[model samples]
Target: MSGYFVTEGSKCKGRPLTTLPVVINRDLSRIINNNLQLKSSHDLEHLRYIAQQRDEWTKLTARIQEAAEASQSEH
Candidate 1:
């Protein structure tokens, strides 16, 4: 679900600092897409950090699993 609504032709913030809703409207899709790209970048950074920390990868895996589970619960 997206976070913003639309009015007129210009794109407005969904909630001052939130991305707009895409499913409800297409105007918000552009902003939501930018957010997705940023999130994807962050996810890649997390995975890359995990890969670089092989000395403690076992511990890292446990931490990653916990983080994944916590994020899943958020959904």
Candidate 2:
């Protein structure tokens, strides 16, 4: 769910940034897109790091089974 929201927000945010360079100058658009690509590559690496951390957490917590059982019992 958080991923979906972030992707939607990025789509909206990217539109104006991309449109601005295109409206101002053709060459500028290429430069802006290249920078965006580099930023996206970094973002991908960051997300992978986050996923690794999450997997570590799951290992530490026994795959969250305790929390799930507690929630089920509460209901």
Candidate 3:
């Protein structure tokens, strides 16, 4: 998925706002699922990595939600 940010604003009146293109890597679904499976299987070797993946997934989803809210507010 993708996101947008309003980077700059017009100093004068009747001018458009400047938007910056923000790209988000949203390809962690499979990885997250795999991590969940590993955890369910009681795999202790990669527990640290699995926890990290879960945290990253959480942050990514939160950012997605924030972006959606921002877009709605813009409209």
Candidate 4:
């Protein structure tokens, strides 16, 4: 029953921010508690793929944020 509750977002223009629950299942919790270690090539490759996806998403998010800021500034 112990997990994380992630609350993200800023209160803009007097709007209330909401909190979202991120539940880590028992298997994942156990794995995390045990200190995850790569045991094979497959695991390493999978980790690399995840890292690449994360990097891509981060870049995309930055671009979107920049566009939004630029649009807002135009007003």
Q: 1-75, model 2: which lDDT tens digit per residue?
A: 123224443244433555432332332223322222222445445434645897754553343455456557989
Q: Tens digit of lDDT per residue, candidate 4, span 10-70?
A: 4357643432211212222223223323444454455456548988547544554665566
TM-score pick, better of 2 and 3 = 3
lDDT of 1 by residue, 1-75 (tens): 211222337655676443333221222123322222223444445546655888655765455466556667989
Every model's TM-score: 0.28, 0.27, 0.32, 0.32
True-structure lDDT of candidate 2: 0.41
| lDDT of all predictions | 0.43, 0.41, 0.41, 0.42
Off by over 4 Å in 2: 1-3, 6-48, 53-57, 60-63
| TM-score ranking, best first | 3, 4, 1, 2
Task: Arrange candidates by lDDT, descending.
Answer: 1, 4, 3, 2
TM-score, cand. 4: 0.32
For each of the candidates, give the backbone clash count.
Answer: 3, 0, 0, 0
Inter-residue clash pairs, candidate 2 = none
In model 4, what is the error at residue 24, expressed in angstroms? 26
Stretches of model 1 off by over 4 angstroms after superposition: 1-55
Among all windows of 10 consecutive residues in model 2, the one with the lowest summed lDDT is: 29-38
Clashing pairs in 1: 4-14, 4-20, 4-21
Between candidates 1 and 2, the one scoring higher on TM-score is 1
Model 3 residue 69 CA deviation in Å? 0.2
Regions of candidate 4 where Cα sits further than 4 Å from its true position:
1-52
Clash pairs, candidate 3, are: none
